[model samples]
Target: MNQLSPNRPRASDQMWLDAALDLLVEAGVDAVKVMPLAKQLGLTRTGFYHHFRDREALLDAMIARWEDKNTGNLIDRCDAYAETICEAMFNLQDCWVDWDLFDAPLDNAIRHWARTDADLKQRLDQADNRRKTAIVAMFQRFGYEADDAEIRAMTILYTQAGYIAMEIAEAPADRIARVPAYVRLFTGQDPSRNEVERFRARHGF
Candidate 1:
């Protein structure tokens, strides 16, 4: 069991949500009950009341956190300054390469949970559409027509999601070797040597 700060009166709302997310990732949504989390936090069940009204409230907060951190932050990074479509794609790649920023385990867990929950399935669908829209806008900024941009964006985003779902195990060397080709295939533009080097340096691959 994980313990909270010894000096604090109790855990914060975010702390509880973080613990819940950890359990969700490890044992699915069914394991994200208040009693287990309270036990993990070294607190009583009543302590959870200080933060969430009930399990549903906690679940709702978790989804909101996921949206803010994963969707909102990724979209913001995509909208950051990029002189070309390739650069914009690279900007998005920064999120993909850095698992810490994107939380792939949490993403996989939520997606699995959505398989049986209609409401959650709807939420996931909306998030996917929004993400694709952001990617399309990035291509449009590089002068691609709306239809072309949409198709390219879908291909890029879907391919990334497929990579995650497949859980392909490969040597880091092999994966790095494929980066240039992947960038070309996704963006329809060959990445410059400097761009590839910078990506390698950023990801240390």
Candidate 2:
């Protein structure tokens, strides 16, 4: 298991990991080389080595940190945002849009490096499975029965990301506009009419 200090007050490793993710979002994942991250954090190569065995170790750590944050807080954050169309996602689409639009492509670019780095790819797969499982549970919360919820949620997890790719490549708003359809499909509700609207109108469709 990947150990984390999530219940603790945070550590320099955590800061380094956050800085790395910031670099990922800002300059793409290729820029997350150990040397560059160490320099960005004012650490010498020796200092960086003390924390992570190498770039692969650092990448694994980064993925672990992201999963920790996601599993711990993502659902709560969506519920707190409970008054929007995404709230119907229970708003998961809202939570991940930024990452999918930006970081996921960056992650894909990093995968080219993964072909030569077995450990990084292994960690990546672990992180990917953890995220998929969490999202599936979130769908069950939206009222799908367990087995069906897992299937529907995985469809969104694996498939809707193409919309993010298309939006990034071409017509952004049109791509985003279609996202609610995915949530509706999973929830067995129609985007054109939801419980929120039904409540507002005091009627069911």
Candidate 3:
């Protein structure tokens, strides 16, 4: 839908990043080389070079765009959903895991890159902090007094990351479908349905 398209002065930067992020999703980061982006966008290398200095510059641009769009914008959007802490936490977790926002191969590639790239890892750390802050706010609203926000946040993040990893594995859908139950356990929420509870216990989650 070209959702990242910016108005006027930022237009060229937006176009370049849209092409880069698209390429990253469709073909993986390694496939987002300058030549392919130019070809895909029907632009010459001269045009691309005008917007981005080089491949690393393009990735930096993409990371900036991601931080602005996902961490800054989307997190604010989450506050409009629920009132209480547990409800908000579950809802936010549910919203974040929506398939529309997740691309398994792209996710795997980003994690791989983060391992060796300190700059990208720093960016991820910022996003991670924002998420934890939001989650801690939710927990505080639920009457939890531990003040261990960072610990809770890291635990939740690790669980979500592990869940994504499990999804990418060869596990059958019937088994992987227990993710919601595991989510309930981690969030300390009681499942509304017997089936959900049964699923949690069955998975030892």
Candidate 4:
């Protein structure tokens, strides 16, 4: 009974996922419904079925995307090569400034959504644990003791999470200027002038 043209492809899953994420970031999780998403994408509801089983499936995909980008990239940055803890701190700080590497708005939205959904909250907890554990390992690699590393890791994660939660707005140049002090405070060692310059250059400051 289907007469769809073979050449015309249906909307891809990423398109649906991106639309859902936009809605979620703008209006919260309740706004991420299938009809609204299909309408936003200018695609038929029938086409959505090809990519996701149901609304819940689409939401699960959103969470997976969030974890893949935010949590996964942070871990990758933590594992990136750095000669000193300060350099490693800069590597991790790259995520704080780069939206592509870490979607702060989506992260904040997910945290808000998790408050109402117990399953999501549990998954969020697991993600936090994984992030903190990786950060602790990064510190330990630079010769920090277990307790010291754990405290520093928690400080770094919690501080950035607070910034995301509060939605603080600071100019890029201003934030970059504070990097030296931040690195020093977080790592207990001041970054060299050259290290700070390199970090700024990497961010085009």
lDDT agreement with native, every candidate: 0.84, 0.59, 0.62, 0.93
Ranking by TM-score: 4, 1, 3, 2
Best by TM-score: 4
Among these predicted structures, which one has the highest lDDT? 4
**Candidate 4's residue-wise lDDT over 1-205, tens digit each?**
9775665546899899999999999999999998888777777888999999999999999999999999999999999999999999999999999999999999999999999999999999999999999999999999999999999999999899899989999998899888789899999998988889999999998
**Prediction 3 TM-score vs. true:** 0.66
List pairs with backbone clashes in candidate 4: none
Runs in model 2 deviating more than 4 A are 1-57, 65-90, 100-102, 109-114, 163-172, 192-205
Report how far off residue 151 is in candidate 1 (Å): 1.6
Error of 4 at 194 (Å): 1.8
Tens digits of per-residue lDDT, candidate 3, 1-205, equal: 5353453233387787877887776666678898877777766676777777889888887777666655554365346455444445545544344434334444555666677788788878777788677766666666666566556666876766776656545444544465565556656665455544443454344
Q: How accurate is candidate 4 locally (lDDT)?
A: 0.93
lDDT of candidate 1 over 110-196, digit per residue (tens): 899999899999999999889998988888888899999999888887777887788766676677777778778878898888888
lDDT of 3: 0.62
Pairs clashing in candidate 3? none
lDDT by residue (28-105, candidate 2, tens digit) is 667888778766766666667667788878877766655555433444443443443335463565445444323554
Each prediction's total of clashing residue pairs, residues at least 3 apart in sequence or on different chains, is: 0, 1, 0, 0
